[model samples]
Target chain A: MTHQRWFTPWLLVAPAAVWLAVFSLWPSLNTVVLAFTNAKPLGGGRFTGVENFARITDDAQLGDALLNSVIYMVVCVPLLTLLPLLLAVLVQRKLPGISFFRTAFYTPVIASAVVVALIWGWVLEERGLVNGLAQQLGVLSGPLPFLTDRWLLLLSAISLTVWKGLGYYMIIYLSALGNVSRELHEAAFVDGAGPVRRFFNVTVPGVRNTMALVSVLISVSALRVFSELYVLSDGTGGPGGQDMSVVMLIQMYSRGFTGHLGYASALSLLLFAVTIGPMLLLLRLNRKAA
Target chain B: MRKGWLIPVAAAAAVLLLSGCGLGGDGGAGEDVDASGEVKGKVTFQTWALQPKFTDYVQGVIDAFEAAYPGTEVEWLDQPGDGYSDKVLSQAAGGSLPDVVNLPPDFVLPLVQQGMLLDIEGADDKLNADYVTGGIDAYRYTGHNGVYAYPWYLNTDVNYWNTELLAKYGLDPAKLPTTVDELIAQARTMKKESGGEVYLMSRKPELGDLANAGVPIMAEDGKSFVFNTPEAAAVLDKYRAAFAEGLMPRDVLTDKYAGNAELFNSGTVAWTTGGGNYITSLATDNPTLAPKVIPSPAMGTPPLYAQGLSVASGSKNLPTAMALARWVTNAENQAAFAHLVNIFPSTKASANDPFFAQSDGTPSGDAKVIAFTSLAQARMLQPVEVTGAMSDIVKQQISLAISGDASSQEALDAAVEQCDKLIGQ
Candidate 1:
């Protein structure tokens, strides 16, 4: 009976355990192994012993990609972390049509990233809506190259990331806000604390942990961004291919005759390393806070 | 309790590690086949994005082939256009490629390097005489001697101009540009006359353009890129000067720029290059602008684009697969297929067919006649060895040159250096 009990539990877990081993754990290990080889997409390769990693140091494109990621993370972390919380607070109360507003705010989260990026591409084009309006109002003499200039293209992709991320992070904030003590809010109100003052002292402190979590999430996503930049730049990685992210580089090396699976795996490892920094920092900060 | 749980977990890990070995196995080179055997067996045929619209046409071909060759069966697989390259690579890696497959010339290069495609010429020498010389030459790689695929349908780029847009911008449609220099001059005139309200050129310089300007894109040995020559730089400089003068749109070099066809359909660009079927497709997409389109022969040696059927080297039914590949691309079948669409047939017998020779007096018919004539002179302007990665490098460098971020010579030099490194890899 005791032996059967152990075997039965194993049988129950076998499907999920096998799935995890095959999909997640195996691919991760294979990536580490492949990083040391020169595997092509069509399958023949040999171990080159850190040759791919060595190539990374001299890669100008990787330099541009890393810089783009830093800029993306820097701009995204603050905007995504704060704006969503404000949006959540605005729609948190059980007022008439609050559900409608909440749904409207969250609609972008449900939209496909490629579809969203393409829509944003048309909106930011030289003869697109924003430029036409800006010109009509006499705000500018010439159309701004929103999708052409390097800096403007990067800023446009960043804006898209923030816009698409707003509803998602807002929902996370909404759930965290519900856990804040209503009694503390009432007590603050009785003491004549204004909305802004109460928000700073009570609401801000209450959701500090959630904000930390959201910041880390935004930072990681910004570093891993591909579709927004890819679709916006029409997969050319913007002018001079300077707007590419690490993930986009990985994709570039994983397709067609240009594909180098080993190199792509190496890039994947680099991305994992880059993202782990913010994640580990978050974990340490959360531990200290606890 | 710990030991009992560990046993199952360790067993699972072992199984997974063994399975991983299978994933890393090489896509083995197929053994040579005695393709002279009787054509009898089941063969898998694959086409790219040809279903629904051409289902009846393809099915009729298959049925006719089957009836002609007794004891032969063909299973057809039509794949969607998206992610087709990835799908083919995966299939090749697994050694599960179809017996016969449709692929573009560039797409067949890596497979040929891997020995995944059968050398059709070596299999059947007589088949070579049936295809047009240019079509046959397309499947022959620079370093490889054998033709890897049966030449199927061929098309060449034809220049399309919007007469209405040209008239609106005070440019004469009757005096349309026929050379690159003339095109540039006309663009400058249109820009100055329209006050930059419309554009005549909306495309960046690609490898085909460089080749058209007499740049030796690749070395004679096909081992290195030599397009960094003075002539290439001179061509780029001309484009840079035009770009600086705003003859082309600023966004044309960026990803935000729509393709020439889309811009032409919108009446924003007065000139664009498209295939023989371009007007037909344009009429379907934009009916109002169809009548205003005028077709002209492409400037410089028009770029030839060919789609061919390649038999997998490892096919179980090698004889039948080879036979089916040949039968489908035969002059009769090719002419029949061409009749349904504006694409030119690749077979030599179909070259002088009256159907392609005569125009029904419409603009689309004119495009057909022009394209058919262009096919006679068209060559594969872009070398088959230029991979996607190399193209990306050229695009980025040329963009930087046109945008004045780098000099034309510097950009071409950088592009050559990077492309040589890629080929070396």
Candidate 2:
């Protein structure tokens, strides 16, 4: 009788399982398979196993993109992780208009990416507010080539991502901070520990689970930072086309040469490996913390 | 009278036969359909546009098509512009695409290379007999042999000027600028006349997407970007000169499309580029705003250029799609489309129409002269080559130069390096 009940339950879940297997698992499997084949979007072609990956590895543009991606992630994640924690701490003080500050930080995350990008484009354009103010303040005589120069373009894109991520991540940190035992902070204060020490030693340790989750989120976010780069650099990435992300590279391969679908699939697998391999390691560490 | 009746019957029979051949060619090599005889099924068009815009145009075309072929119903799966080509490719990969799709000209060749597009060369020939030569070529992406795309509508960029502003600045409405030098001189003259109360010309008018559009004024060869070339430098120098000389305000770069158009309507900007294929409607749409068209003066050596449109190869309904495309380019329909769109027709016949030649005599100026001059020496967007990095190079370099972040040379050099990388030069 129990076995019959278990069969019905399995049967009930079969449709959804099948749906995931077909839509998700199948496509992923296809991506991995096609990575080794010279199959195009429309017509089948010869197998070119490891050739696409070898080409990507050898390509100078991909190298630049990879370097840029690393630099972007390295620069952005720390700021994204720490800034929100600080903001959450500041806002958690129950000071005057703290709710307003919290709302302000959260507001940017709710705005559409396109709107955010457009507004940022204006603020960062050659003669935009930053330059104008800098000029007025005698900080610089001319505007920075924020989107034109490869280095500045990467920096600008990362900073914009940070700005957009800051508020949302801050809210998350705040919720986690709220869940921290009030007794811990009160005890830390009783021990004559300074605010900074308490934050680093006690507060951080308490929110370890949230930190692990948010770190993974930020890491993945860094890996897929497409919109900011696309919008800022007008989809060319940047000058010398050095800032094109792996995702952008995949898009170009898929689109520009529709006949090169196999190569694109290969690139897709490469991206998946680059993104998930590290992500899985982080997940393991996160599991260890539990 | 009997001879005329025979000609009519013959013409009708010919169209039917041609349409049939077109349908057969599109439905794989051996697949054939008797769409002429009581065809009843729903065919969907996959294209780039949101629901409202897509629905309106698709519905309009479908209604016309269904009225002509009663048993056919057309549905739409509107793809957003973002990741549009990718969406189409994914469909192609899965061997599933809508019956028709409006493909960007650049995507046609690659799709054709994938053997995705139906070879509608024969049907295209019929369309070419009626459509403008250049317009047809816009759809001919293969350079030779394969004709993958059909020219749906022809668009050409032109100069939209404030006639009232020109006259106010003691400039003759008939005498538009013919060269880069003349354009600069006109801006200077207009600024002095206006006493710096308004800009002589706006760099980028803050209009919707115009701010980020980054339309580059490049060289003729399309091999080299001129935005940083001496000629481009000269153009930029003239712009910077205009700003420095107080002929144009530094703030002009902040102007959007609406602001720029408004500037012209309010007699501020002396001249600017008109909305391609929709200049006339821009005027007609705003009856109170008096604006006129002028030919875009040669910034470089020879003829001026405009962007073009082409059908996508991924379309499943190539026969009906080609037929509908032909309908948009036919002399009568071209005239109607041009009249409705309020822009110059690509075809010489419609362009040379008495209606286009003789202006409606609106208070702004002679619309016909404006239309004709603008169409006389038009160029087209450069073909996708070197990984299709031309547009990117042009946009980046031009933005740098315009913003004065980099000298014309530095920007051009950087752009050249990028292009070289893409082309493997």
Q: Relative to the true structure, how large is the alpha-carbon lDDT of every model?
A: 0.88, 0.60
Q: How many clashing residue pairs, candidate 1?
A: 0
- The sequence of per-residue lDDT tens digits that candidate 1 reaches over residues A28-94 is 9878877777676665666678888887776778899999999999999999999999999999999
Could you report the DockQ of all the candidates, in the order they appear? 0.50, 0.23
Model 2, docking class: acceptable
- Please give the range of 10 consecutive residues that has the lowest summed lDDT in model 1 chain A: A1-10
Find the 10 residues in a row with the least total lDDT in model 2 chain A: A253-262
* Native contact fraction, candidates in order: 0.47, 0.12
Candidate 2 lDDT by residue in tens digits, A250-272: 66656544335556677777777
- CAPRI grade, predicted model 1: medium
Clashing residue pairs for model 1: none
- Residue A126 displacement in candidate 2 (angstroms): 5.6
